[model samples]
Target: MSSTHHVTTESKPVRLLLIAVAAFILSLFLLLPLIAVFAEALRRGWELFLASLKEEEAWSAVKLTLMAAGLSVPLNTLFGLSAAWLVTKFRFRGRAFLLSLIDLPFAVSPVIAGMVWVLLFGAHGWFGPWLAEHDIRIIFALPGIVIATVFVTFPFVARELIPLMESQGADQEEAAVTLGAGGWRIFRSVTLPSIKWGLMYGVLLCNARAMGEFGAVSVVSGHIRGETNTLPLHIEVLYNEYQFSAAFACATILALLALVTLGIKSLVEHLSGHTSNSRH
Candidate 1:
């Protein structure tokens, strides 16, 4: 028994060391390009980098990107949470079909998704006449950008919440109901607390995607410089126009945003683990 225990402990360290090495190699491969971008940005010096931020077109792209991301993240969160709740908390026909549909964006190409939106809302398309009559333009506008983003990011929150909610079980909610707690009261006190971390995780992921989304948005936004153009689209525009420094600078900012978002997600996950343990 002593020899067996020794072998088991020894094997665990070997397994962990292998995993650590593999992860390190993968991370290095992933980070090389990002490091190259930062190196190039610095090569151009700090003054140029600072000036890139002050450029009028860059500023417009930043503002539009932030606005679209801000608007879309909350809306996606609401839709995600609602979908998660319905799918996880209830049983109904076509549940599997609904879940599959939620993930359709992941499988569909972004360009194709853009085309579908165009077909639905373009001037000669399905809702075009109605929208034109009301002067409510969608395609080639901010509304189109938002709609495209929402479509692509629809699954993030729901996917995050479903497993968390499922793991939490319904015991606490049942207890609240037994005590005559109302629906809102039970959800606020029990459900929300249980899933808040997961929800935030999803929101952060959605925000990142919304900020970086390009293809679908580009198709609908019409690439109007300083107007419908988002950050990613702006980068493409700059690259196309041979403004390499500005494009790289904008790309670097986006990379930084993604990194910050990832850091927050890691912190949230850490806190969530502590919260989960304390609840036990």
Candidate 2:
């Protein structure tokens, strides 16, 4: 017979000191920087902050950023849902390899991912001539931005769903099918309700990454003011040109987005927990 022993710190003073150290590090590294971004943004006054966001280049960047997120989020959500369902509901050869492929974005550098597309679509690349012949511009355009965002955010939804679905298993889905429900019907009636919270959590994270992605989008985007610049790229441009207030002003938007994402994510987790407990 064997027993497990749990080791824990019992000294109150040591525990208190550890907690204090952690709090200090959190404040110094995370909280303070966020505070500075907002303070610096609003330092020149609210009017200036509003004006900075209202600038032509700034507004354009906002639009492009929204466009990229709007396009990429849905595409990735669909792919994630399909991939997660396929992986979790069936046993197949090369299953592990397929999962590794899905996780490729996380392993690859964002810059390298962007460059891979460039190599495939840029002038003198294999498809470049074909694209040019068709008068379609991909690299250095909206298409490239959307594609890069999709790649970087590829794993969020599927990663969120795979383990949850695996743990939940396919018993309910099989039962629904036994009752003569079709694929879409079963998915909507049974599977969706089971995984909706996880789906939403994944989507929120995907949208945040889509909006905030910098390195990949930067490589694909030409940084053309009022054209290809996303919010992060625009912020960099402003800072490089010595426009500190405008840069921080733009940063506040992204920071606010991150805050909102975090709030929603927390709420989702709480609601999911409450529902789970109620079910049990």
The TM-score of predicted model 2 comes to 0.95
Model 2: lDDT to the true structure: 0.95
What are the lDDT figures for the candidates, one per model?
Answer: 0.90, 0.95
TM-score of each: 0.91, 0.95
Model 2, 81-167: lDDT tens digits are 999999999999999999999999999999998998899999888899999999999999999999999999999999999999999
Worst 10 residues of 2 by lDDT: 1-10
Question: For candidate 1, lDDT tens digit of each residue in 1-280?
Answer: 6777666655778989989999898778887889877777666788887898789989999999999999899999999989988888778999999999999988999998889989999999999999999999899998899999999998999999988888777888889999999998988888997789989999999999999999899899998888999999998998898767778888998999999999999999999989889888
TM-score, cand. 1 vs. native: 0.91
Looking at candidate 1, the ten consecutive residues that score lowest on lDDT are 1-10
